[model samples]
Target: MVFFKKIVLMSAVLALAGLTGCATKSDKAGYAENVVYHVNDSVVAGAAMNNIKNHLNANPQAKIVLVTHGKGIDFLLEGAMDDKGNPYNVRVQELKAKGVTFDVCNNTLVGRKIDPKTVLPEAVIVPSGVAEVAKLQSQKNFAYVKP
Candidate 1:
């Protein structure tokens, strides 16, 4: 029984050591090279933007792009507010200051009867949301993330 206990304890210790080593290696792996988050919903748009903020905080050199289309454009609508009635424009501005790019779809604007001028000034009008995603992927090699 004493020998069995010693073997079990040794195995447990080895398992823990292996796990710790893996965790350290994962931390060293660091952030991805490029990340693009596609925003398609109002609520999810906010969450995705916040995720980008967090990513940027952890990886200061990380490249992030937010592609907004369809209903997602509502998030950047002028005077838009969150469920708590907090304006999102300021948050967008803050993200822009941190080098995050916000891309708005012109097709969505026209389809939704929204004027381009009514969007946040920080947002750049793109030709089409779907096309933009493809362009980013093919031309810029950006990873498409639909969060």
Candidate 2:
């Protein structure tokens, strides 16, 4: 019985490995993939920006979409700042210039009672950030990253 159980476990592991291997081969290169970066918290917004910048630097042809909701949308607002008072618009604009798309959740704005006019012009207001992330990953084959 023990030997049979071991064989079953090994088979399961091998099957999973095969699936993972096949999944990773979707892109010609790691950085050349369509990527969606999810940001639900403002605390990591700065780090997310850096990560997107690094991704673009590594692969200029890569397509990157940043989906923001909840507190994460704070960074994309006009005149937004970090803990140190560094303005976020400059970095956001720089990334935008490099072809990074920023998406803000309209659901978040309605739920939080934030004015849509307050959002920066650069960001596209999606109906739902989570749904947008899902659509990118499932329908668009975008690799998901949360940094």
Candidate 3:
């Protein structure tokens, strides 16, 4: 019985040793992989969307957050179309499927007089787009991109 107790204690110690570094390692990995994309220009919206697609294609596991304000919110508006006359829904939905989150600025809606109900179904409205981007960078160490 003493020998069995010793074996069990050694196994427990080994298991604990293996788990000791997991928290820090996992945290570092998440900080490195988290990314934020900011879009405030209506003209470059298409390019920005394409860039996000390429980024996700390259890093399938990367966490992507897109924050939009000002004219940037145009693309998320209902019945919106790009210069090619193509609706933005298909691409937006595709990105959403790949775990990309789209955040619209509530301040923009109020300032621009855009109806909140007109925002794309998948997008979430935050209090402020600029503040959201800053929060992600300062608090979560997310890499910021303006593409």
Find the candidate with the highest TM-score and give its number: 2
Q: How many backbone clashes does candidate 2 have?
A: 0
Q: Give the whole-model CA lDDT for all candidates, comma-separated.
A: 0.86, 0.92, 0.89
Per-residue CA lDDT of model 3 for 52-126, tens digit only, reads 888776667789999999999899989889989999988889999999999999999999898999999989999
lDDT of 1: 0.86
Query: What is every candidate's alpha-carbon RMSD to the true fold?
Result: 4.5, 6.8, 8.7
**Model 3: worst 10 consecutive residues (lDDT sum):** 23-32
Between 1 and 2, whose TM-score is larger? 2
Separate clash counts for every candidate: 0, 0, 0
- Write one digit per residue (lDDT tens) for candidate 2, span 54-98: 887767788999999999999999889999999999898999998
Q: Candidate 3 versus the native: TM-score?
A: 0.78
Clashing pairs in 2: none
Per-residue lDDT of 105-127 in model 1, one digit per residue for the tens? 99999988888889899999999
